[model samples]
Structure formats: C-alpha cells, structure tokens
Target: MAVEGGMKCVKYVLFCFNFISLFCGLALIAVGVVVQVSMHKTFRIMDVNASAGPIILIVVGLLTFFVAFFGCCGAWKENHCMVATFSFFLSLVVIAEIVAVVLGYIYRDKVKTMIDNNLSDMITNYKVGSAELRETLDKLQETWKCCGAQNSSDWKDYGSDGQSVPDSCCLEVKPGCGNGTMTDTAKVHQRGCSDVMSIFLKRDAQWVIIAAIVVAVLQLLGIVFACLLMRAIRGGYEVM
Candidate 1:
C-alpha cells in the first residue's frame, strides 16, 4: 500500500513538471517568432543576411513540446520505457542548449565588427541606393540617434560639395539640416551608428543567452522528474 501510494505521488509530480515543460516549449516558440519578425523587418531593407538562431530556437521548441508530451504520457501510463526515452531526449536538449549558449557568446563578440563594416558600406552607397534602402538608413539613424557609421566625419568622405549627412541625423527635423558644412555639430547627432548599434546588439544577445540558460535549467528539472517517475514505475506499478 505504501509503495502504491508513493508511486502515485511520483506520477502526479512528474505530470506537473511535464505540464510546465509544455508551456516552456510554447514560450520558446513564441520568442522565436518575435525574433524572426523583428529581425526581418529591421534588416530586410539593408539587405543583411538573417541569422539562423531564431529558426534553431523554433526547432528546439518543437522538440521540447514533443518530448514533454512523451514524458506526460509515460508518467500517466507508468511506462518505464517511455519515461527513459523522455529522459534521453531531454538530455539531448540540454546539450543543444549548451552549444547554443557558447555559439551565442562567440557571435556576440564578433558581431560588432560585422555591423561596423556593413553600416559603413551601406552609408557609403546610401545616395545611389534604392528608395527602400534610403528609407531603411533614415529609420536606423533616427531610431539610434546617430550620424554616420563611425562619426559625422565619415560623411565628408562620401559627400558631394561637402554635404553628405542625411537629414535623419538632425537634432530636429528641418530643411537643409543634412546639407552645408559637416562642422556644425549643433544641428546633427555626434554619436556614430556603430557605437549605438553595438550596444543594441549586445543587449539582444544577452537576452538570448539568458533565455537559453533558463530553458536549460528547466530541462534539467524535467529530466530529474522523469527519471524519478521511471524508478517508481519499475517498482511494479500497474500500467495505466
């Protein structure tokens, strides 16, 4: 009787843990969708290559959902084999998360240089680019409150007749703000796009890293619960 009662307790506990894992999986997918949409909207016009991080997240999310489902079924049916399988898959997920965190850290370190070079090229070709490209650059400058890729002086190199900066750099919207001599710091932003964008990228990467860590912790918990339930089932509980 005591053994049966203990197994029941284990089953319920495992069920609850797997239920939480189901929601965590859904949340990961939602995060992936949000990241994909934001990245596509922000960089589509700049012709920048999209990162595969979001897609990987979505794939992991789906895997997590299925694994959790198997866990729940295993616990409910008191099936040792199914519970073992769940633990195995959950371990794989933990491994994948570790890899993702390492890759994310590396990418975060390298992204600043990539952004600087891309922004420089975009700024240099802004005048002759398509209207969509121009609009994208204007929005980026306005959003970040920055001027050229490095500094306002970067505009001088590409400027015709010493007027290269776009009006988007203006402190206030007004005519001829981008024109005339580039020396008037009062009218335009002093900070460069690279500085602003580097901060933004770092913040984004930090959030991803944090999320990956949280998910890994949750997976670890789920594995613990699944393993415990497997032991309970092996103790001779009838399969439901």
Candidate 2:
C-alpha cells in the first residue's frame, strides 16, 4: 500500500513538473519568435548573418512548445502511457541540446582558424598599410570623445573578431573596413550575454504578460493533477 501510494505521489510530482515545463516551453517559444522578428529589423542595420543564433533559438523554442503541449495533455489525463511518451520526447530534446553543445566545441578550433586567416588578410592587405590604420584608429578615438560627451560608451570599445560596427559608427572609414574590419569580427559575431539581456528587456512587458498566463495555467493544472493522482493512489493502496 505504501509503495502504491508513493508511486501515486511520484506521478503527481511528475505531473506538476510537466505542467510547469509546458508553460515555460510556451513562453520560450513566444519569446523566440519575438527575438527572431526583432533580429530581422536589427539585421538590416547590423548584419543579417548576425541573426543565425536567434533563428536557431526560434526553432528550438517552437520544438519546446510542442513538447510542452504533449506534457500538458499527459498530465491532464493522468495517463501513464502519455506521460511516459512525453518524457521520451523530453529526452530527445535534452539529447539535441547536448549535441548542439558538443558540435559547438568540436567546431571551435575551426572557427578560430578561420578568424586567424581573416586577421592575417587584414594585416597583409592593409590597402594603406599600418600607418593609415593607425590614423584611422586615431580618428575613431576622436569620435569616441564626441560619443562620450553624448553619454554613449558604445564608441569606446573596439569590436573584436568578426563583429561588424554599425555604419553610423564607422561611416567615416572606407566601406567594409572600419572598426569591424578587424580579424576579431568573427569573435564579435556571436551574441554576448549583454545582447541576450537587451533582447529580454526590449520585450519585458510582453514577457510579463506571458509569464502571468503561464503561472496561472501551471498552478491550476498542478492542483488538479495532484488531487486526482492522490485520490487514485489512495484508492489503489486501499485495494491492496
């Protein structure tokens, strides 16, 4: 009887976890879509290629949402088969994430090699040699002063590794060759934590709304599942 009751409790807990996961997955999907759309707009001024991460994020988000839907259905029904099925899907999602991380590691050296090649090209091609590069850099420093006065520290740091500076920042320089022209542009292309934070802040209100909905849904679903599973377990144990 105790074992039966414990199994019932475990089921309830799993249901609750699934419920929360469902809501979180949906929220992530929504946020991913927003981020992708925003990236499109930002890419026009920045680099369209810069959006690769968001695009992948959007796909992953959608998949998560789908998986969450299955989980929610499973929990609602208290169907062990359905819940187990959903768990299988979740496992796949975990595997995919692990694979992504591994691929990133595997390709890291290759990425670095490409960046080195680009930097070497910059040093060799120097259309105007290092002297002109130095003068251009000085001009950038002067511009930084102006930006600083305007309370924009954006100009103070030079982009590293394949990162593109906005045209506005490097407008004075030859096209395709300014602060972003450095070999480090490749490195800069990856979105930083700050970039992710900016995206979140930009959609703060939307997230708040979505979060509220998710929380409410999860809570309601969790309670319903917990009570139902508890009753089912008690009955099963009594029969034992």
**Best lDDT goes to which candidate?**
1
CA lDDT, candidate 1, residue 117:
78
lDDT of 2 by residue, 18-98 (tens): 656656667676776787775443332223364675676667667766766666666556555555556566666666665
Q: All models: lDDT?
A: 0.78, 0.47
Global CA lDDT computed for model 1:
0.78
Clashes of each: 0, 9
lDDT of candidate 1 over 1-240, digit per residue (tens): 246565567678778888888987898899888988876545542235644667787898899898999899888877789899999999998998899799878777676677777787887788888887788878888888888888878888555676657888888857677786466788888798888877887898798789879878977987887777777667765533
Q: Any runs in candidate 2 off by more than 4 Å, and if so which?
A: 1-5, 41-50, 109-167, 170-240
Worst 10 residues of 1 by lDDT: 41-50
* TM-score between model 1 and native: 0.86
lDDT of 2 at 7: 52
- CA RMSD for every model? 2.7, 12.1
Q: How many pairs of residues in model 2 come into backbone collision? A: 9
lDDT of 2 at 206: 46
